[model samples]
Target: MQLKTKSRLKFTIASLLIVIFAYILSNGLIIGDYQIKSLGSITKLGLDLKGGVYIEEEIKGENISKDTIDRTKELIELRVNALGVNESVVTVTQQNRIRIEIPGVYDAENALKQIGKTGKLTFRGPNNDIVITGEDIKDASVGVNQQTNQPVVQLKLNESGTKKFAEATAKYQGKVISIYMDEELVSAPVVKSVITTGEAIIEGSKDIEEAKRLAGIIKSGALPVELVPATVKTIGPSLGADAIPTSKKAAVIGITLVMLFMAIYYRIPGIIADLALAVYIMLTMLIFTTALKATLTLPGIAGLLLSVGMAVDANVLIFERIKEELKLGKSLRSAVDAGFNRALPSILDSNITTIIAGLVLMWLGAGQVKGFALTLVTGVVCSLFTAVTVTKFLLKNFVNSNWIENKKMYGA
Candidate 1:
């Protein structure tokens, strides 16, 4: 009797703690100035969810090489990052075009002005002769001047650039070598000495942020091929705002019905399954908000809902197996063990196959398809753990506690 009491106490405490943690994760906690954001707020929403602008730009010249297109895409991504847009995606698309998706950005014209510029960097002499181009730049980084403690951009040049720069410095030691980006004057630094080691520095940035921005632009290099904006469109946030609440309602209603059905039909085991399901939901959201940093989309929500159903289905299978074992005159503990053991193969086969399919979709698909695959795979994996491990552990503890040993409660 004492052992049973201890077991029940431990199980009750554990279950309560799990519930509290899940609640905290879903709704967050706040104490004074300290606050934890809920999973929904922490997880990033995709362009479809947050509503931003997408621009498709086509290469102007015909028969553009793959290398050129890839380079352009990379540069565009860097420029987008420089614009302080987080979670922007730059993808090479069909017909020698590249697509850029900037989420949470509403100013389409400003975004275009920042990312679509040619950014052709050049150093010109007194007579306006080109001394070096962006292609000659090997690297550019923001650094501080050790002597003055001021922000500056350090440049590393290629071999040809080094030779040309050395000549330019020698020819105009006390004269200004003006730097230009797409014909707009950026800087004019006087050549103090001939630099033969291929390294240079640009000073006079107003602050560290300005220095970093200039460095980022220079580091991205110029686009290899000219590009023209093929299409530009903006998605309004109102649409996403509407979809989010609807998705939440659907998930809540569906999960509630599943939980009610499980508790009604399966009794004790169903309640435990619902607890495990809660853990699964918390775990999935934790992954999306932290490890994966996944962007939630409408399709991703569908995947999440589908995986929730799968989790319940797994629990149902195990409960039915337990009922069969109970009918065979097995003891309660033996029936529980045998049920999980027997259901293991089927559970593994289904989850494994689904995971494989999700991986394939993630690999081959793009945009919303990829988002769906990511959430589906993550949710399915979490479900497998909760079903095979968490649910089994909880059920075993309840059985050992002997608090509710009635065969009817076990659905026998």
Candidate 2:
């Protein structure tokens, strides 16, 4: 009775573990700031799956230097990304135009307006207190400070700004106030006096050119570059909307049929193999969504299906080897161990070669090719684990528990 209880406990624990693993993959995990998104939610569908706005714009100038173009592109990317856009493809074209393709974004006009806004500038005091904001900033100019005869920036603020500045300067007198442009610290000057004027002088430019650059930087921080929209168009989802549902249905049907076949052919071992295969599916989806974050393109789905088939094939190979050993009058335990050992080399060799090919494709290919390669590699690795570790665990537990004593149940 005690032995039976121990066996039941072991089996229950194993079953619970499998259930927990599956749940984790499906529901994901969140601990404080760290989070793992659910498999379906984290897997981003490509532009092919979701229609969006396509925009093309170029920097306004003749013979624009590459550095300037790069800077402009960087700023545009930063602006868009900072606005909470995800998976936005911003690429520079041959004509030096910046093309932005954002999947699932439909409002081109508002998106353009919001993305090009010159971010707010602020003055922060001790403990990161907001001393003053840029609500009343009017114009900034570069000029020579009369007293020092040095190049400086002249800033004009409205009446509201003047009052706030005067109050902050008087309150935080002798303390430091850091100036920030788009959250980047441009300057941190100590307050020397409380002036009630609306105009302020920023001194510290080494030369006229430096003063001009600083003035331009501040002005740009207040006013973003003019974006001349060359073209604004909406693209339909490259893949039809029905593609995902159809692919998912196909995957479900295929996996179900394969599991049924395994159970029918190999009997007890087949059932164990099916369990491992189920785990393989969960792990692959988790890797796809969390680890690689690979977009689920059509080719990606194909690769995943192919890998699933390979996982079944791996189980078949091991089961065949086990059957052969059992036919040679080996004990179930000996047969299982020897079969797995013999199958290991072949499985590793084939999977390793496929993984290498997938890596090569990832290195050389782009777009869907890389997606296919990524899923392919991920699937192969997961299948390797299910075939070797998961299958072994299930088989050992069944045999040790003496759930089935007949070799015939193993398809021997």
| Strongest candidate by lDDT | 1
lDDT tens digits, residues 36-92, model 1? 888866777878879999898888987777756765776677668777777787887
What TM-score goes with each of the models? 0.76, 0.65
Residue 153, candidate 1: alpha-carbon lDDT: 92
Give the C-alpha miss distance for residue 87 in model 2, angstroms: 3.7
Runs in model 1 with CA error above 4 Å? Answer: 1-6, 60-70, 94-96, 120-156, 159-220
> Which digits, one per residue and each the tens of the lDDT, describe model 2 over residues 1-412?
6654666577668767888877776788898999966677777776566777778886676777664555466556655665566766666676767877677877888768755666767878867888777776676688997888999888777788788888888988888888776766667777778868977877777898767655555554544445578888786775548888888899999999899999999999998898899899998987787676556767888899989988887899899999999999999989999999999888889989999999999887765677789889999999999999988888877777877889999978
By TM-score, the best candidate is: 1
